[model samples]
Structures are given as C-alpha cells and as structure tokens.
Target: MNARNAIDMTAPVQAPRDAAPASTWHSQMPDDKAMLRAAAELTRDIAVARPGIYWPDMLASAFVGYAALAGAILVSHPVAAVLLGLLSALALYRALLFIHELTHIHKDALPGFRMGWNLLVGIPMLIPSFMYEGVHTQHHARTRYGTVEDPEYLPLALMKPWSLPVFALTAILLPVALLVRSAVLVPLGAVIPPLRTLVWERASALAINPQYRRRRPEGDFARMVFWQEVGCSVWAIAVLAASFAWGWCPLLIALCVVSLTAFLNQVRTLVAHLWENDGEAMTVTAQYLDSVNVPPPARFSGLWAPVGLRYHALHHLLPSLPYHSLSEAHRRISQHLGEASTYRKASYPGLAPLLMRLARSTMTAR
Candidate 1:
C-alpha cells in the first residue's frame, strides 16, 4: 500500500500551463472545524472494529487466493493459467491489505487476529505485520502527515512525468526483493552486526520516503519482529531449496502472481493521494484534501481500493473507524455536511480521472 521509490528523471520535462507557483506548494489551508466536528459526532457508534467481519473476510480471501493460485500453477492451458493467476492476485491483494487495518486497530480489538493474520497471510507472503506496525502510524501523525517524516507520502505531483510509470512498474520486483531480503541479506546480517543494523534501518519498513530510516524495534514489537523474521527466513530458504530441488516452474508462477498483486497495489497507491504536498507539515484539513475518496457509482473502486481504502480521505478524518463501517460513516457525514462542504471536495468519480489528474500534475512539475 506504500509507494515505491523508483523514478527515471533523465528525460526532458516541460511544465504544464496550470502549474502552481513554487511559493504556494506549502498548504496554508485552515482546518474545517464544522466538517471535523460532524465526522466525529456522526460516526461514534461504528468506531469499534468488528471481529466477525474481519475473521470471515480474511479467511475467505486467503482460501480463494491459494486455491486460485494452485489452479493457475496446475492448469496447463495458457489462457486458463492467466485467468486463474489474475484471480489469485486480486484475492491475495485483498487478504494482504489487512496489514493496513492491523496497524490502525487497537491491539485488543480483535484478540488474536494479528497473530492469526501473520500465520495465514503475512509470514507466508514474506511481509510480516512488523514492517507496517510502527511505520504506518507515523504517517497518520498530526505533525508528520505529509512531511518528509511521513513514510507513506511522496510529492509525486511535483516530479517529472516519467517518474510515475517507473514508480509503478518497479513494484513488480517487490516479491523477489523481499525474498532476497529475508533469505539472503537477513541471514548474512545475523552475523555481521553493522549489516544487521543497516538492513533493519533501511529495508525493514514498507516506506515510500527514500530518506526514512526505521528505528530499531523494541519490547513486544522487537520480539514480534524477531519471530516474524525467523518465520520469513525459514520460509524463504525452504521455498528456494524446494524450487532448486524440483523444477522452478511452480515458484516462478507464484512469484509472477505476487508480482502482479504488488503492481496492482502500487497503482492503487499512486491514486490514493493527490501527492501535491512538498514536505510541509500539513494541517488536518489539508491532509484530508490531499487524500482521496472514490465514493459510490465509481463501481470498480472496491476492486482496486479494498478494505475501506476507497474512503481514504474520510479515513484521514477518522483513522480508527473500522473498514466495514466506512460507508455508513461516509453517508452520515456527507448528508450532514452537504454537497459544497470541504468533505465533498475529496470525493472523486473514478480512477481514470484521478490518474489523468496525477499525470497532468506531473507534466507541470518544475
């Protein structure tokens, strides 16, 4: 769900006609207090995370994903394999996105849901919950939301046009990169103390900011990271050994499926924000405006931005609102605030326009 830091800036760039002046890049927008009050008072009832929804949805998604992956690998027909692979990618993508929820929800909200998720999806996917737990919360911090300290934010709208494609495409390599990190670099780092420090700081978090170095995990988090690291290392080594001992076709197919999933997530991340912030500490209203919401009638927003992410702008408003409750929450606030409200400004019709707008913004970046 985080943007990848890959950009090819060698090409000649031209500024678009609508480009804003450099002096206006920092958000000076005042917080909309009425909208903020409505958001809090309207959604207080649905703020709690429901375990029933979380457990069933995650279990089903993982089941369907693995089943479809098995079908993709076993089916000899090229067309059938491609179709099944795509299905696997989408289902797993949804399952994997529960990691985002894990970060926001209280530790006691769902009891053992965190450990269950790791056993089922996180460790198996080589993306244990530790990578996101401490990291994503910082992105939601009041003073750090769009600043350089925010691991998930990047000023893509201020970059060269070519950077977008490169940023998106590079995510295809993430699965393989994670495999290398766990199977190769991690094991090596276990002996070399300096290398261990370097890997933990630089490669541990799922962050977009190239300069965002992670601090060492501590207490319970450190313990969790230790176990997750062991799990990933063992899993990765076993996978590589099996692939080598047998033919590499199955592993290759699995990697390709995961790569497709990562690519889809990267594309989703691209449109999740307006990406106009230039590292300034934004106000809450500014953060919400900078975020996006592809509300109903878009139809396919659910497919790309699952687990309440389509209401990302609303999420910035109420970070603890459970995924299943976002729609009802959105409706209450929207009707209360009316069409001309600042809340309405964050809602977009669909993905195409968002993409076109981002592309245009990049074209105008100086």
Candidate 2:
C-alpha cells in the first residue's frame, strides 16, 4: 500500500506530546559516524539518482502539477479541477525532495555528467540549491539556539495564552498568505529590479557576515538563491505571457497551485519544530526531535512530508546522507531510537486538529 494511503491524514492525530518523552528520549539519537553510515546504506538501497536533469519522480509530478493548474483554469467542473489542483499541489511538495537531495549530495560525484541538472531541479521549487544547502548544512551542524543554527522555529515562549490568539490568527491567515505571496509578492519581487537587488544583498549578508564578505562571497550560496529566483521568474513570465495572449485564468490557476503547495510545505516545516522548548532540547537534539519525518521503505510518505521531512529526526541525526536514502537510513536507525525518533503517522488533517489541541496545552508540551 502507498504509505500515504496508510496515513489517515484527515482524522484526528492523538495529542502529540501527551505521552511523556519516549522511554528512550533521554538518550539522544547517535551522531557517531551516523551521517556516514546513513549515506552508505541509503545509496545501497535507493536508486542512484540523476540530478539537474529531471529526477524521474519529481519531473513526473511537476508535469502533473502544471497540467492540473491548467486544468483548473480550463476545465468546466470547478470541483474536479480543484481536486486535481490539490493533488498536484501535494505532488509538487514531493518535487521538493529532489531539491533536498541536491542540497545534500555533491552533483559532481554522481555521474560526471550534468552539474547544471542539480541546479535545474531546485528552480521550480523557489529554493536556491546552494543557499539552502549552506543554510541547511549549518542547521544540521547545530540545531540549537543563538545565531544561525535553528531552522526558523518560533520561540517556545511564543505560546503564551496571550499568544494563542496570534497562532490562531496566523493559522487562519495561512491560506490567504499563500495567495498574496504567489500572486502579488512573488511576481512583483521578480519584476522589480530594485526589490530583487535589495533581497540579494540582504541574503548575502546573512549567509556570511558582512565583516567576512571579503572572506566568503558565497559563490555557491548566492548562485543558489539567484537561480532559484530566476526559475520562479521564468515561471511567472510564462504565466503572464499566457495570460496576456490568452486569458487571466491560466495565470491565476498556476499561482493558486504553486502557492497551495508552498503553504503546505510551510505547515510541515513549522510543525516539525513547533512543540519543543528552548534550553536543553535545543542543546542536545538541535532540531531533530523538533522535526518530524516519515521513514522510508515508504517513499510515498513524501506526498505528505516533502523532502522526506517525515524522516526529519533521522536526518538531523545523520545529516550527510543524500535525501534519496533517508528512508532506509531512518528505518535502520529507528529500531535503535524507537519513538525518540518522532516517527508519527498522523494524517495532515489529523495533524491540524492535534495542533489545535496543543494550542491549549502547556507551552512546553506538544
């Protein structure tokens, strides 16, 4: 059965943190050559991937997403169109896994063939392979407090009763944020050169401190961020060209589909880190326990958790493994870590109700 089918994403997820830390939670997932072992295991199992050029799965899904968006625009039945668009959005999230693979693996090592193929895979997802690679690398190196380690989680103190209103408002506002982002913000940010330059400068400064600019220009990082945008810009241009010569519907459909996928991606990211508190948890596990992932032997899990994010705790423990092999790596290690691995199967719909449940729980609890 498809792992996605195994998941009941729509039903209620049990309150995530109600169970006290796993019997083994006190023992952190091992980090001793874990990344190395993970890589070897994953490579032995998952297909030897071909980057830059279409990853067979990600490519097939990208076409599905694009076709669905087109259908959403032209198809007569609104409901079927919306369903297809939703499925496509989910498929696009999986496409992000190929991008994650590029971030983790060195493209040159694989096939002496197309290095550009690695970069090409990242564009449609709006992620710069280089920038994200660096950021995510640092994130894995130290998933804790202060400076650049954290993967952008809200501060734990953020869940005060007073803050409840804020999380609720933000949760409600998410869908609207997607529309504004894809339709207005993303498109405008691309067309306006001044805005684009400002963003680039700011990102460069962040990637490497300005004081160290002379030391590190982030050739890879900047290129990653740049081409990622370039891809989005190209996508935007295509939509506009079609809309102008034809009609607005196609463009609107494209924006809706892309944004919907991106929004779901964000939900997965935030929740992965949402429940943990700052001090000890940050120091030890970094973002591993805070992150959620579906383990492999179940690749289909990517539909709900992009980039093998479901196997996140395992990845954090073993960062060097290429994404394609995360599943097997996770499965092998999971026996050792057990629930300390944070391998839950809550459906996304169930996840929402669970999040709402936690909104009322102890700030430190899940």
Error of 2 at 234 (Å): 4.9
Give the top-scoring candidate (lDDT).
1
After TM-score superposition, the amount by which residue 49's alpha carbon in candidate 2 deviates from its true location, in angstroms, is 5.5
User: RMSDs, each prediction?
Assistant: 5.4, 7.7
Per-candidate TM equals 0.94, 0.64
Poorest 10 consecutive residues by lDDT, candidate 1 = 5-14
Runs of candidate 1 with Cα error greater than 4 angstroms are 1-26
TM-score of 2: 0.64
Candidate 1: clashing pairs of residues: none
Superposed model 2: Cα runs more than 4 Å off:
1-54, 110-131, 143-151, 156-158, 161-197, 201-217, 220-238, 279-287, 293-302, 336-358, 361-366
Reference-based lDDT, each prediction: 0.89, 0.49
Number of clashes recorded per candidate? 0, 12
